[model samples]
Target: MGEFLIDLKVNKNYIWVYFIAFYTLWCIRELWLNLYLDSIDSVPGAVTSAIIKIIIWVIPVILLVIIMEKRNPFSYLGLLYNVKNGLKWIGWASLVLLFYSILNITLLKNSIDFQLELREWLNVVLLVGITEEIVFRGFLLRKLMDSFRFWIANAITALLFVSIHFPIWFYKGQFEFPYIFSSILTVFVLGIIFGFIYKKSKSLWSVIIIHSLYNLLVSLFY
Candidate 1:
């Protein structure tokens, strides 16, 4: 099981350290938010939340590529470049995913409410979409592929991607059956899909845009 992970840490051993640290810190961020910062609304709260995520979710992965992998962060993470390919992949992905959304609403008889706040746009949509991809697909999935096959690595990475959301679900009291189970499964599937996109396009931005779009659709619909 363990041998299925990326071997970058086997000799230097810092990869798992960063992974563990980031996971623990993300859990703590949720705990602190629900425990204390829940009431900190408005711009201040959004700024604080974004800052927290930047520290915990964004920084560690950047450091991992820069320090551990000893490579350029942008190149390592497949960001800001490969624009054409990213667009091409996202174009195809959007068709399939948007079809699902259309089918969902058609069956459910729901319309797009099309509402989003500034904080959600900044913190939830952009920040989460960008950073989470950086951590999971750009960093983890690519690294994991060194040791394990794509599907195997992607499955494990997807489970991990699901795990990171548990604390927030737990804190928000959304960790019950049916909802939790379904949500976890959905997220795991998303992780797999995102990995596939990244693998095909070799562009993190492709996954990022699709991920942000998924979140945006969910927000607009429900």
Candidate 2:
């Protein structure tokens, strides 16, 4: 009986290891999808870009769910499919973010630039805001919280979030210390705020809406 119990424990550990490995790899693949989708400048229509973005984003999430189902056949789908609750959070977060944006723009005297056309704006809303939120808040943060304490998970995930923006500085040729410092600091602060929301609500939709609205306000004001 003792030997049998030890074997069962080892098997359980192996299963968890497999789950973590699979989840990480899937996340990396999703990151690659985002990079590739962002590179497609020749795409003509807003609908086309939106469709391609959805495909890239949804495929991996579906794959992850299938893997989870295989691992835990009795897993409840309700935990993952909380769209209604998510929308409620999003509604409230939107109001708060709107106010935040107005204050930042008016009080801080941030300049507004409306260079992006409607199609471009739609692409930004779908690809950059929604899809990225699903990947970061829904996938990476959730997985990290499973393995680490809440605060530690939030810190590490936030750092990763900031590091991923390194290419922006490179492309702009503004890789100065001050620019890097400020960008990281701002993202870290935003990450902490978003992480707090995620922790409190446990709903990705809330943060997704908040992030989208925040970006929209920044674009409008700055």
Candidate 3:
């Protein structure tokens, strides 16, 4: 596990430092949230978690910026750039919504209950989407890409993304093994897709939109 990261240093070993710090902080955040602050599915819980996530995810990325002082942080993160390109990617991802909708209306029509809440929508889109993508696709993915190829870096990010979710999910009793496997697969694919979008456009905005929409659509199935 550690050997893979042996040559991952750049800008005074900031990538390795950033990577380790972010995940370490994230694990602590997850443990606290899962064990002590376990209302994550509720509106208040989601909002609180998002705030904590921002604090956890943002600080390291900011440090990455400060550490690598030659580049603008937003540019370094590939964020909020080329609005037209971002919109184009969002258009491409619209199929995700269509596919999920058809699946819900067809196979899951009877079994699934669909409802939308404005608060949850805002949290998922603005808070969850912005914060997570900044950390994963924007910060970590960029750092990984600096060290490795796109697919390899994206796969690594996806695996980490999925692995992190499990402990919290298990703590929340979301661990039927089959279901867990499927969920992991789903998120891995999602991470790849999000990474691809970011790669294609060299911008994080569209990836954020796609991710938020993906979460919104998936929640409809729940």
Candidate 4:
């Protein structure tokens, strides 16, 4: 049965089914965490949430890689950037960070307290950035491109990416009209940017670096 499913061609319909199953399971896990997990502001809650998120996002992606690519999941996700490419990605990421910092400093300068500890940095990079990039840009974008035009696939991915965050943000009391709408729009734009980077570099590392830095900056400034 498993072999039969694995043998199915990766067409649009199959990708749609895969995407649906992926998010259904993901949404359920997120909902359960929000319902039972403590507020993320607390250190323990934040740690627990990070751990659970890694488990939730990573395991399915691993399975997908094994089934579809039949190879090392990290390489399948384009995680093998050499030093030269890594520096190149860092250069691009620097520009992103510069613009992000400027935007926040100029317009949305909130006096949010930033807990710039080692653990927070680790969580942002590993849990939030790497895991999400692998799921959305690395896996979802790759599959969608195989089945659709580039712009169309990216548009769909961006929409779903924005949609996925809504549940958790709403649960966490960030559903205020102006805030939620603006946040979603910002995320959608970022999703497009991330997709573009993945398409250009053929790797997830650049986008992951950008995302982790962006998240850290947002935590610091807004």
RMSD of each: 3.8, 5.6, 4.5, 3.7
lDDT score, candidate 3, position 85: 93
Reference-based TM-score of each model: 0.89, 0.67, 0.82, 0.81
133: Cα error in model 2, Å: 1.7
Model 3 agreement with the true structure over 1-222: per-residue lDDT tens digits: 575466333453676666677778877877876675546667777777777777887776876676665577887787747779999989878886887788878887734445565446656556678888888888878877876889999998888778767666776788787788888888899889888888998888898888888777667665
lDDT of each: 0.84, 0.63, 0.76, 0.77
Clashing pairs in 2: none
- Cα lDDT tens digits for candidate 1, 20-64: 988888888888888775554567887888888888877878877
The candidate maximizing TM-score is: 1
Per residue, candidate 2 scores C-alpha lDDT tens digits across 1-222 of: 999899656643443464355445545544554566455444454566567556655455445646643432112212345667767777887778777767877898777777765545775654566666665566556667766788987887787677656655555465688767888899888887778777676666667777877777766775
Residue-pair clashes per candidate: 0, 0, 0, 0
Better of 1 and 2 by lDDT: 1
Query: Which 10 consecutive positions of candidate 3 have the poorest summed lDDT?
Result: 3-12
Compute the lDDT of residue 110 as modeled in candidate 2.
77
Candidate 3 wrong stretches, greater than 4 Å: 1-12, 36-47, 110-119
Q: Report the CA-based lDDT of candidate 4 relative to the real structure.
A: 0.77
Report the lDDT tens digits of candidate 4 across residue range 37-78. 556546777687677777767788788779767878888778
Q: What TM-score does candidate 4 get on C-alpha atoms? A: 0.81
